[model samples]
Target: MSASELPYQYIVLRCVPRPEREEFVNVGVVLYCQASDFLQAGWRVDVERLHALDPRVSTDQVCAALEFIDAVCAGDPRGGAASEQPRGTRFGFLKAPRSTVLQPGPVHGGVTTDPARQLEHLVSTLVG
Candidate 1:
């Protein structure tokens, strides 16, 4: 199905560390459905995909990543409130780490870094 026809919204989670060190890597989680419906089918698929890509990552870590994406999308410098709001036409959620410098970095072995880039990769992987 096309992204517009999907049954639920999609979310992009980005993770970053405070103090900005090279060791601080950013990881993204693409959760399906609105934040309230995160336990649904599409969300499960995303969660499974995330685990399949990197089994070492924990659920808490993914949740943290989601929070980060939400902040960035909300345009809140402090990561915004931990509540769901009506996103515009995009029909998706976004969160990111509570950091200032949002830059690209290398992906570690077995980990999928960069939510936006990862989403693009996912689409290409499915289509091609």
Candidate 2:
């Protein structure tokens, strides 16, 4: 049977520069569509708000991490071997939780006909 929609998963990257202080700001988002072999990420950070959250929050560090997410989405060499794998695998790598200034949030799933549009919707609703 043909399918009109497919299930996908996503994670929002959060910056917790001051984890001890229990502060975090959403920095980016990662989305994966296994059926379509598509993986993409989008990010937007409010520097002033980030600084207000933690004066020590480093924009350079967060930007680099966000860029890394984009590179993984593009399968760029900068993303290393993980990005060279299939899109689903790349998504897995990106979605893995990490203890750092920037890290992926819990994985959320939904159905979508267009992964790109879903990505935009996720960014706007969850992180925008």
Candidate 3:
């Protein structure tokens, strides 16, 4: 990678209505570039798509969780102590595997000169 390009890691956020069923709907993305001290999250919830997976899925809860992720990325006071952690630590907390309605998918890596733009691109390409 060129000097201008920085390595970044990201995770696709998913809404797993039924973990037992092993199904999920892409709801958001979290990205971090330690080299550039950048971290952020982007999200969108398709109600129709989520209901199709499980009629009982709670969009509000999913949204709240996703919002928390965004807060953490932004180091917002609303995110509490997690947000106060170092950026890399916050990213690590987010990318850790979990079994919940709102959980992250596998971690992926790439190189980019603009971490923010790459985050938007991933949200469009993978979470859409």
Candidate 4:
């Protein structure tokens, strides 16, 4: 299906304690999805916000999220080559089969660690 025609979902992950205190504990995942044109863009913005909130968040993890979006836009979940169509016509405002998967870990920690693995698991779960 076309990116615009496909359904999309977003899942946000934040540290526990709604008001977010310095000593807040780890929280589980939070998932939200609605038909909207701004989901993908919001995901990008959230990545920045996530890093700002916790400098520990690694660039690799954030890149993973961005790469996921790029893959979907290009119609390749595996991060393959972009489709033949022109960039403007590719997405066409349709929501893609996109999702944001978040995992908590120490800031600046290696993405090769547990949280990154967890994120990979989430992607695999969604891809299947």
Q: What is the lDDT of residue 12 in candidate 1?
A: 28
The candidate that wins on lDDT is: 3
> Candidate 2 or 3, higher TM-score?
3
lDDT (Cα, tens digit) per residue for candidate 2, span 1-128: 23879888999989998878768988788998888888899889989879999887789989998888898899999988887988888888887878788888899998999899999988888777
Candidate 4 residue-wise lDDT, 23-76, digit = tens: 322222212123332222222233344455665755576556455545544456
lDDT of model number 1: 0.37
**Candidate 1, position 107, lDDT:** 21
* Residue lDDT tens for model 3, 7-121: 9999999999999999989999999999999999999999999999999998999999988898999999889899999999999999988888998889999999999999999
Superposed by TM-score, candidate 1 places the C-alpha of residue 127 at a distance from the truth, in angstroms, of: 12
Which residue runs of candidate 2 sit more than 4 Å off their true CA positions?
Answer: none
lDDT of 2: 0.87
**Residue 50 in candidate 1, Cα distance off native in Å:** 1.8
- Model 3 has an lDDT value of 0.93
Q: Provide the overall lDDT of each model, using Cα atoms, as 2-decimal numbers.
A: 0.37, 0.87, 0.93, 0.36
Q: Note each model's CA RMSD in angstroms.
A: 11.3, 1.6, 0.7, 15.1
lDDT of 4 at 6: 29
Question: Clashing pairs in model 2?
Answer: none
lDDT of 2 at 86: 85
